[model samples]
Target: MRIHLTSVFVDDQDKALSFYTDVLGFVKKTEVPLGEDRWLTVVSPEEPEGTELLLEPSGHPAVKPYKEALVDDGIPATSFAVDDVRAEFDRLRERGVRFTQEPLEMGPVTTAVLDDTCGNLIQIAQSA
Candidate 1:
């Protein structure tokens, strides 16, 4: 079976949506009310009908600790493959994105990490 959805915890849904869409260029797929918070999801522009990335609320007890652990370890909550790591990094930076790690050669890939401005670091990578 194919994976249909994945989640990434975010401190604020609105901010996360803005960053993911306006800055990173993903398109919103769904936004449904779920009790106090909403179930928000986005998809890549290049793959509109592909798997969704859920922007889960960070305050949820089940995910709080896991999110914290990932941030503490400097591990990105999610990664997006790019055509050119350096160009994407530069473009993102020009759009006011803050990066935690600069582009670096990593064996078979060139990668960089940036703060999503919501709660977690997101990685951008390209084949080396």
Candidate 2:
């Protein structure tokens, strides 16, 4: 009845791991070798047992164009909830994260979009 695992296609697993952990503050949960790729996943530090975010490889032929089109239209590959959008945006900007869209507030919700550095636009959102 609840969500379990989800994934974001990545161009490089190692780089994605670094960005997701060192930069975004997620922690590695599982890493299992699977032929040419690994079944790598990460979970929020605050929610160690929560849903896992898989760092899947973008080796499929259809993935490139799908990613490109999403980027071209300024769409996020996935969104992550944050306590405060502006604060998170500032923190991420200080770390040299490139944002396609700055924090914008709409009623009770605020959001910002940033490039994942692995071929996807990711969004950080907050709701008041």
Candidate 3:
């Protein structure tokens, strides 16, 4: 059993595409237009054939409140694994990305959270 795809709601696909690719370093995998919305997805550059992360539209009525509540409680919409949390955090910070939480160690794991700029917080983590 293997994971195929997952998604994160975005306010704007184009903007999210740029951020995910240019900043977050993911590569575009699929893009099929569907009027006001599109079926877009991205994959980690290092794992281009791995699980896909869909850039879904936040048009659903329930999504707004769900996202808001998560943000209000300082929760991440999703997490991505990194080789080194602190190094990744510094690399992103140097690119002008805004982080809501700095890297913190928790036992054998370290994590940091940052705003996705598309109305969601994303976490980067590393484990020993």
Tens-digit per-residue lDDT, 98-127, candidate 2: 999999998999999999999999999998
Residue 90 lDDT in model 3?
96
Residues 3-57, model 3: lDDT tens digits? 9999999988999999999999999999999998999999998999999999999
Pairs clashing within candidate 1: none
Which stretches of model 1 miss by more than 4 angstroms?
A: none
Return the top candidate by lDDT.
2
Per-prediction TM-score:
0.93, 0.99, 0.98
Per-candidate count of clashing residue pairs (backbone under 3 Å): 0, 0, 0
How far is 28's C-alpha from truth in model 2 (Å)? 0.3
| lDDT comparison, 1 vs 3, better candidate | 3
Candidate 1 lDDT, 2-121, residue by residue in tens = 989999888899999999999999999999998888999999999999999999888858777887788899999888899999999999999999999999997999999999988799
TM-score of 3: 0.98
- List lDDT for all candidates, in order: 0.92, 0.98, 0.96
Better-scoring candidate (TM-score), 1 or 3? 3
lDDT of 2 at 19: 98
Question: In model 2, what lDDT does residue 64 have?
Answer: 99
Model 1 earns a TM-score of 0.93
